[model samples]
Target: MNIAYLPIDERPCNTDYVRRIADSSAEVKLFLPPQEALGYKKLPADKEMIWKWITDVASEVEAIILSIDMLIYGGLLPSRIHYLRNTEATLWIERLRSLRKEHPGLLIYASNLIMRTPKYSSSDEEPDYYEEWGEHIFLRAYLQNKKQREHLKKDEELQLQNLIDTIPKKYIDDYEERRAFNSTINTSMLKLVKEGTLTFLAIPQDDSSEYGYTSIDQAKVMKGIEALRLHQHVQMYPGADEVGATLLARVYTQLKGKRPRIYPIWSSTLGPQLIPMYEDRPYQESLKAHIFAAGCQLAETATEADIILAYNTPGRVMQESWDQSDKDITYTSFRHLLTFVDQIKQFLNQGKQVIVADCAYANGGDKELITLLDEERLLDRLLSYKGWNTNCNSLGTTLCQGVLGLQGNKQKIIENIIYHIIDDYIYQAEVRMKMVEDFLPLHNLTYFNLKDKVALVNKERNKRVRDAYQLLIRHSFETITRLDVQTFAPWNRMFECGLILKCEQSEVSKKC
Candidate 1:
């Protein structure tokens, strides 16, 4: 299959991840735009150049998976900060229409984010005024929506009115006007899906909450989807950054005309019902939505499954990845790690392909889960292992890798396993916080801005990752003579990093 993927941004998770998984299969030929053309943070990509590139390859590729934010608004951050008028934005819809007209047979899978309203005051990814009034803006909308939906106490009413009166009207006006514009654009995309300009559409909610601007907008979009009766053609879920890979998986499955059955096994008895952070729905509900979105089915029995998704979720309580060192007692008392690993071993013994979704903590992998897998020498044996950013991000990418791994070469699949361990586990869960705590202070650096000291920070990062690899993985996998892992701070921040892995490999007939 020939696929052209336009990522959400130049992030490694979006670009390199899809490429590595696609490379696992010789049958899949994937094409991506030049990284320089994709632009930097808050900078719009060269849309004309990207459009030309896509048109040039449209005739040859079987499918084109696109990030509508990138194609129209330049990138995800640009989408949030863009000054494009509604009329100007609508022109991009026409561009999509033209693309469809030019290539009627091309399958178009696209994703657009419903702009997020962070609960905290941080202008790092939002507007400058957000540094002062971001929380106020989120609360204004949240309180107003809550008041309308349910009764509010007198104190709550006073707080809402106080926020309305205290915040600068201009700031609120600007933020809301842009949201209205983005919402219109979302409706326009749905219209495209209905008209057959797009084959599949995913509207992923980023940093979504139970109630607020995001959920309210979701209700509006849900009404739009129902009005158009496009449920079968559209999927709305809690995810960002991972939607591209999810759609790519869908395209791969549709091209092969196979809906692989997946059987899910959870770490805790109550894990499936508990909602992870930054999302509104329960973990298992989101899992079902993702499975259906990926062109895969939920297996009723392990005997009939093609993939065993060993999902590692939270116990009675959930916390950030960095807090795993002092994790809640419920993690041990409520969830049994021994039973989880034992089930994974049983599945492997039964000759089933297994994929691990290490979602016990948000923003990194679960150390306890990774340690158990590593001790059992099952790290490189799984089809995929992902725990990064948000719960949905990990779930979506893991599913994509699992689907592609079915036809992947053993070497490529093993390489992906090592890649995730280094990035998701070694870097995100452990080293990132260590640098912020230990290394950053030595250079007078903050987590948000590494400044000119990025190289110094990354130098320390690479060393720590290499050491962790030696400690956690090298002993079990002796086939890897030397593993040189380099980490890059793409946004010059500690929240995420890009990894370049170099491995010296020897031939092995069996799984490590």
Candidate 2:
């Protein structure tokens, strides 16, 4: 089977992840555009080039998983910053209509992001002037939505107006107009889904909040979906990047006509209550949504489940791993992390497929968990694992990969598992993050954005980091998998990497 996939960006989670997950599940081919055509933090992808690529090759594939946002605005970030009139936006959107007309029977699945109103003062992911007024803009959106949803007292109303008045009218006007355009384009997408132009649509909330302009925009999108009776095909949730994985899992499950059952085991009592970073809801709610989105059922008991989701939730508060539970920061205890490893070991002994969501702390792997798991030689035993981005991203991605690992060639599956372990766990949660903090600065760069002389610096810095990663990752994987797999960051950002694993166990040199 051949599947044409258009990722939101060139990030690991959106691009190679789709390839790795699909490769593990079935013997299928995924066609992706050249890396240059997909956008990055502030770089808009070459949309016209990608459209041409898809047009030329899409006829051969059985299905396509596209990012509707990417098709129209180059990527999720570009979607928010792009200045386009309705007519100009419609010209690009109508390309999908043309696609449907061309491929009448092809299954088309796509996802769009609900623009996030960043709460920070940094313009890393926003427009330039946002660095000055981004936080204020976010507060205004939050207070406005909160005020409209419930009510503000006379004093509170006065405060809200005062806050709005402080923000430059130009900034507020640009932000509002951009959001209104995004919201309008999204609803127009629904009309396509309603007409069967799209087989499935997933609208993931990007960096959502409880009370913000995105929340209000979400309500408007939901109303349109309901009005068209497209709830059966459209899924609105609080997430991004994970959408591609979820949609791919859905396609895999539907093709097999089998819905596996997943049972979640939380190491901490407050697991469900704690809301991880960049999300609006608690962990359990997002897990359930992701499970359903992946075409899987939730089992009440582990005994009835085909896969087990083991989360390293915090005991008191979820602290960043780098913080080491210091200075009032929340963290899971050493004893609890040890106990959690024992639980996963028990599952492996019980002959059950276990996928570890190692979010004992967010943004990286639980150091103690990885250390102890390595000492016990249990990393290779698990079905899958994830702990890189927000809690929602880690949990959903691990679930999707685990669900897909249920089938496929055994040796091939093992290779795929090792790949995921390397990328999602070791590289993301451990090495790459440290490199971002320590190594990148030598070239005057930070993880969030590039400093002066981006083009030349990015190239030299990526080489330096990638070379160091190849060395460090070699040692890490040796302790776990005992395989010296060749790894390279194709995009030169250390965010997404390509691995060429050779099967030494087989008589022929096997490519995995």
Candidate 3:
């Protein structure tokens, strides 16, 4: 089936991830807009060009994956900064209405983000005032929301009120006003979904904490969805970036009429409850939501499961290489790491289809686990492996690929295997860590803005990443037919990459 996708921004997580997973499916043929027209952290997307492309392709594709933020506000960053009047802002709904009129039966899957107030001061994605006052505002919101949830004593109430008052009323007002505006837009989109315009709608909480604006907005959104009383047509979850891929998986499941059963195995039993940064709930809740979003079922036992998802999570708190550099590596004596690999080996030996979600850390893959897999010749033997960006991002990608692999699509399986090797093992495990130490400090400068330094970084990223692929290709030249690539860090840092490509081959290629 032909699918047209509109990403939230040009970030690799947003742009390349969903398209890659969708195209890897034998049942899907995906089309996307030109990368030049999309927005970055500070820049806005070419709205006119994107809107035209959407209209041109809406009729040709079997389904359309739309990011309402991209359509209404050039991009996610632009959504935060754009100054649009009421009528002008609602024009996107009007645009969608027109599309519905044009194609009476087009399947539309759309997503909206519940606005996130960052904890730290970073002007990279927020307004200029955020650099200094961002933390202060976030604190005020936290205390204020907390006060409402729990009964604060006289002293605590006054302290919270005093803190809120210390914030410049204008700064606080501006922040509140933006949230109000987005809340309005989100409510309008809810109405559209209720009126039969959207086939499926996902409103993901972007970034979250226990007490914050996310909590406040979620309460209000839950009420709105309840009022509309729509079941199986809409949802609100704890991830923004993973929603696109999750929705595409939903579409593919609908097309194929299959709901695969998956059994999840974690390195640490607490891994499922461990909530990483930027998310509100535990990892377990998010896992269930992604599975439900994809129209799949979760199995209670591996024996009854169609697929096995072995998730490598950190024991206590997930840490990145930069933070855990002083920590010792895991050896076979480490029960968590050792037992995890052992279970995976047993599952493989049992003839079970296994997909590894290597999220032992947040930003990159777990080196200890990768080393074990390589030593065991299991690196390229699994159905798939993903260890990039956030845990949910890795989880959803591997989840979809695993479920779809049940269809016995040899082509999709081969392409997915290549992606797993290149992304999870080669880049996340090896090149990424090396490059950071070698190039993290650029031009004798620390904390440099990427706008001035992206070209240099991307140029080097392309060489190192592409060369890794080429090296692997040469090793398995007979099995590999061809390869294509455009790798870069859209966020201007090396936390993740926007790797968009396609590899056509009959046999699965895997080697260390």
Looking at model 1, the pairs that clash are none
RMSD values for the candidates in order, in angstroms, are: 1.5, 4.1, 3.7
Model 2, 1-512: lDDT tens digits are 67788988777668767777777765567788998788665678888998998888779987788898888888877887888788878787788899999999888888888888989887766888889989889988888998889987898788789878899999889999999998988898899899999888888998899898889999999999889998778888888878888888777777668899999888777777778767788888887888888889999998999998888776666666455426123354422666777888888899999888877665656656666776676765777767766777777678777877776555555565566555555555556656677767777766654445455544444454345434433222332223555555544454544555454335343222
- For each candidate, what is the lDDT? 0.90, 0.75, 0.75
Candidate 1, overall lDDT? 0.90
How well is each residue in 156-219 modelled by candidate 3, as lDDT tens digits? Answer: 6787777777878887778788888888888888888999788888888876887888889888
- Name the better of 1 and 2 by lDDT: 1
Clashes of each: 0, 0, 0
Q: How far out, in Å, is residue 231 in model 2?
A: 2.4
Best by lDDT: 1
**What's the TM-score of every candidate structure?**
0.98, 0.86, 0.87
Residue 37 accuracy (lDDT) in model 1? 90
Per-residue lDDT of model 1, residues 1-512, tens digit only: 99999999998889988899899988899999988899988888999999998899899899999999899889999888888897777788898999999999999999988999999999998889999999999998889989888978999999999999999999988888888888988888999999999999999999998888998899989999999999999999999989988998999999999999999999999999999999989999999999999999999999999999999988889999888899999999989989999999889988899999999999999877887887897777789988988999999999999999997887788788889888988888888898889889989999999999999988888889988877776334546756678889889999889998876677753223
